[model samples]
Target: MAGRSIEPFREIGGRLALVRKAYGLTQRQLAERVGRPASYIAKLELAERRLDVIDLEELARALDLDPGLLLSRLMGKDPI
Candidate 1:
């Protein structure tokens, strides 16, 4: 585990879940706020779908996070 670089999708997925949890928001709640499907959120959390910058920004905003911090964390860099 130590030597492995985190995969982009997995990192993003993890960050998504973490931010959602940090805000005490359920997937359904986040999905509703984002105007996306709950299943879509679930798929994103599972890394089953690709995420984009726009979606990243939207998610970060919804969770009251810095977009850059979310992207950096998702890329496995130390969040600034």
Candidate 2:
């Protein structure tokens, strides 16, 4: 998988951006809630960074959402 791009996960970033906008939270605000820098949030939203399980949980909590539901949305699936 050398040089393989992360394009497949790009939609997750798009979904994250939409959710963040829907909640009326700026990237900096969300980063503050997650104890990360604004640039980190920007990177995630741009798919320039990959999200790990721990970060996903933290982001879900900060967004007042269930982690599973958030993951489902990120994966482009309807939440069950």
Candidate 3:
């Protein structure tokens, strides 16, 4: 939420979904890794919610991705 201008969360959500699925993780599975509820991941993926850097870090850790790269992807800079 800081450092960069707020990007459209709908786009971010779609990227997040792509990365999560690429890792072959279910919403529940990714949530377990991030210590969140499946519904939380579901909401984020559906663009019903927003993501902060901390949340992105947790997901990157779970998916073996770099947080910056993930953020870049969300910002429409680089691909995941």
Candidate 4:
């Protein structure tokens, strides 16, 4: 089977990093809020890790975002 594309994850990671920064959060801070390790957040932001739905939901909650809205924004679809 072909490997999954990394481009989409890169985009999401970029958006996630931006959002986290906008909230004045460091990787460590976000990781603490999400109950993950700082390295997990770092790897995720670097696109070296992919987020499953549960992970996404936890992150969205930590970021004070709605999971659907966060997903939409990450996908470049703003539901404003």
Candidate 5:
């Protein structure tokens, strides 16, 4: 899932971790803002669970990132 798929989970997780770090947030903080379990954020960062579109959008918004940017980065396209 990380190295082979078109949406490589490692890349996605890396990007997500980057965004969270850039925002100076912890997994628990991000989870509270997005109303998700902190373990979910940890799982995402670890590439243990795939995030759905709705969850992605919510996370992007919560992190104050453009949803398009999240979509683009996650899809391996140019950042928005």
Candidate 6:
């Protein structure tokens, strides 16, 4: 799945971790905000998983960021 990925999981993971930390939310707190399990957030931040569109949208809303920015960065495109 990682090899077939369209988004750069490493960069996404790093950014996601940074944004989450910047908001002062733990993995569990973010997951709770998005109605997901804490493990899901942890896996993404650890680069052990990739988020589907819905997950990305929910995460963006939870982090108060635009989903486009996250998707752009994850896909290696300019965040225009």
The deviation in Å at residue 17 for candidate 3 is 0.6
Candidate-wise lDDT, in order: 0.80, 0.81, 0.79, 0.83, 0.79, 0.81
lDDT string for model 1 (1-80, tens) is 45645477787788788878878989999998889989888988887877788888788777777887767864668753
> Least accurate stretch of 10 residues (summed lDDT) in model 3?
1-10
Give the CA lDDT, 0 to 100, for residue 69 in model 2: 64
lDDT of 4 at 66: 82
Q: Which ten residues in a row have the lowest lDDT in candidate 1?
A: 1-10
Residue 41 C-alpha lDDT in model 6: 90
Q: Estimate the lDDT of model 2.
A: 0.81
> What's the distance in Å from true for residue 32, model 3?
0.6
Which numbered prediction scores highest in TM-score against the true structure?
A: 4
Each prediction's TM-score against the native?
Answer: 0.79, 0.82, 0.79, 0.85, 0.78, 0.79
Sum up the clashes in candidate 2: 0
Give the alpha carbon lDDT tens digit for every residue of 1-77 in model 5: 44666446666777888889888999999999999899999988887888778888889989887766655654668
Clashing pairs in 3: none
Q: Which lDDT tens digits does candidate 3 get at residues 6-68?
A: 446766777788888888889999999988899999998886777877888888888887776
Error of 2 at 56 (Å): 0.4
Residues 1-80, candidate 6, lDDT per residue (tens digit)?
A: 53675347766777788888888999999999999899999999877887778888899998888887765764668643
Q: Model 2, range 1-80, lDDT digits (tens) per residue?
A: 46977764476677678789999999999999999899998998888888778888899999998776656754668653
In candidate 5, what residue range of length 10 has the lowest lDDT sum? 1-10
TM-score of 5: 0.78
Candidate RMSDs in Å, in order, are 4.8, 2.4, 3.6, 2.2, 3.1, 2.8
| Model 6: number of backbone collisions | 0
Q: List candidate 1 stretches off by more than 4 Å.
A: 1-6, 74-76
Misplaced by over 4 Å in model 4 are 73-76
